[model samples]
Target: MEDGDLLSRALDFYGLPKKFDANLVRSRFRELSRKYHPDSGEYETDILFKELVQLRDVLLSSLQNDPFAILENSKEDPEGFQFYKSAKQKAAQAIEKYFQFTDGNPVYLKKEDNPALLRLRQELETAKNGLEEFLEKFPKSIWKEDTETTLKKISVWFKD
Candidate 1:
């Protein structure tokens, strides 16, 4: 089976959003695992348990390489901390657009080098530039590390 297919199936099985963090995946898996575990005397124990493990592994692995996963817990805005938030949000939206096209599985998009992918890359670059602008404007901002980390994460996609 294709990785995307597996990922989609995993997402469906876990009842998770396309954009999820490792903690969410793990927590959900554990919740389901408790119910489906063979030791719990659930029906179709072996197959269901195995499938859950596989899907959990797939999601966890995919998230590790997922550039946009950085955005999952990045809404840490305090009062008057909107500096460059729009730029970060722009990059996030660009990522979401790509994921939307690919049904949340980047593997599908990575296989094709069409105009859509090119545009996505361009959009990502623009977002990166925005983040750079933020950094330039606020060199001593409290969010400097986060801004830099976000820039580096977005750059990861271009490397591929």
Candidate 2:
């Protein structure tokens, strides 16, 4: 079976989100492993238990490596990295816009809430947090420099 098919099946089996969440995946794995372990006696020498072990290994290995790096290094697809690069660029643009909207100011104005500004502030925080999560997940990403630069600019906006 293809890698994508395997990944899809694994995600479905574990009830994991489509997006990779290391902590969530690990937690789920622990829970399932405890129940399905060979010594757990939950099932007696079954294919399902073996399948779970295999699935866990595959998912963990995939998460441990930089999938983008694999694509970039593949001889079959010379330009495979383009898709990921474009995605990073788009995410960066959204983050930049969020920072621009905040303009280095607090969301509150004169101790009264401006609903519109408050909404924008929330959006900005979400965008920043998303980018931060991405950075943590893909530490060796090609977009690291740009992402870090944007994060630094956003941080300056919050200075007291």
The lDDT values for all models are 0.74, 0.60
TM-score of each: 0.49, 0.40
What's the CA RMSD for each of the models? 10.8, 13.0
Residue 157, model 2, lDDT: 38
Model 2 regions lying over 4 Å from their true place: 65-160
- What lDDT tens digits, residue by residue, belong to model 2 across residues 25-113? 77988888777777874866657777877887778777544334333333543333343443344445545665577676655542144
Q: Tens digit of lDDT per residue, candidate 1, span 1-160?
A: 9999999999999999887767789899889988788887466557898899999999987854453434423555332145466567778888898778868543424526544677778888867876776677568888888989999888777754
Model 1 off-target regions past 4 Å? 69-160
Worst 10 residues of 1 by lDDT: 72-81
